[model samples]
Target: MDEKKAAILGEIPRLRRYARSLLRDRDSADDLVQDCLERALVRLDNWQTGESPRRWLFTIMHHLFIDQMRKVNRRGEAAMLPLEASEAQAAPAEQVESIASREIIDALQAMSPDRRAALVMVAIEGFSYAEAATILGVPAGTLMSRIARGRDELRGLLDDAARRRAIRIVEK
Candidate 1:
């Protein structure tokens, strides 16, 4: 494969991860990633040389996700569903991780889409502020504000969950 094609292909996992974080449903996320890849491939010639392929692909995914959200909102459909446990039994360590993961997912879902997207791009994906801003199509200042607010909101959500869990433990 050419360098450009190889670079695009290498970004699939990151794109999928971002999509999954945004959509929260495995099937929907996969569909979104597939759509993004198809679109990127079809418009490959339009992509400027010397630009970051990962950022370009993420921008595509972000726009698609926003479009999907708008459609769901127009239809008055609920965007998120409760997280469900897998059927397989987990070991103790796995179980702990699963519970913590679910808590974090729930907290993330509680955030506004913009804030959640900023958090995912910066904190989860480890993108630089400028790079994330480019991918999100927002000013660097706006992106920074969103990240700050998202972190605060996420902190509050997690803290509340912890308190609730503590209450349950105490009551039991």
Candidate 2:
């Protein structure tokens, strides 16, 4: 494949990962990724040479996600489905890891979409603050603030969950 096409194709995994985190449903996330790819293909000409394809694709995905959320809000529909146990389950040897992962996912779901996106980009995806800001179409300072607030909120959510779990264990 040509360089441009190859670059775009290489970004599929990252795009899907980000989409899955945003939507928390495999089918919905796949659909979102498909829509993002379709839009990117159509606007490929507008993409500048030497630019980071991953960042550009992320920018497209971010905009599409925002637009989709707006449409759902207008229709008064739930934007995300509840996390399914089957989807969060992992291998026996990694039971603890699986529980921790589930807790983090739950915390992320509780956060505002904007904050979650910023955290996912900077923390999970390892994007620089400036790159994440560009992808989200916000200033660097704004992105930093979002990440800080997101971390604080996520910590609180996890702490609450831990306390509830402790109570359940104690009551047993």
Candidate 3:
């Protein structure tokens, strides 16, 4: 494959990972990745030379996700947070870590898509604030606001979960 194609191919794992985190279903995530790759390939010429394709591709995927969300909203379907189904079956020794992980993911998924996208790009994908802001097509200050609010919301959600878990333990 050519250099452009090679670079785009290399980002599939990251794309799928982001999609999975957003949608919480492997099949949907794979489809999202495929759609992203297809769009990126068709618009390959639009990708500038000597710049990182990661940001460009992520921007495209983010738009697609927003479109999908709009469609779901129009249909009156409720947006669901990713459930910790797999973690629920963890062995005794792994349960603590599993529950913690589950709580974090649930909290993240519970966030508004805008906040979740901002947080994921900066925190999980390791994008700089400027890059993430550009990718999300928002001003730097707006992106920072989203990130700040997202962190606060997550802390509250996780803390509540911890408190509830402690109550359960105390009751038992």
**C-alpha TM-score for every candidate:** 0.85, 0.86, 0.86
* lDDT tens per residue, model 3, 1-31: 3988888888888998899778655677789
Candidate 3 colliding pairs, count? 0
In model 1, what lDDT does residue 159 have? Answer: 90
Task: Give the Cα lDDT of each candidate.
Answer: 0.83, 0.85, 0.82
Error of 1 at 51 (Å): 0.9
- Per-residue lDDT for 109 in model 2? 75
Ten-residue stretch with the least lDDT total in model 3: 80-89
**Residue by residue across 1-172, what tens digits does model 2's lDDT show?**
2888999999999999999789755778899999999999999998999899998999999999999988887886654443433345443453344667777777787788899999999988999998999999999989999999999999998898788779979999
- Please give the distance, in angstroms, between residue 133's alpha carbon in candidate 2 and its true position after superposition: 0.7
lDDT of 2 at 1: 29
RMSD from true fold, candidate 2: 3.7
What C-alpha lDDT does candidate 2 achieve relative to the native structure?
0.85
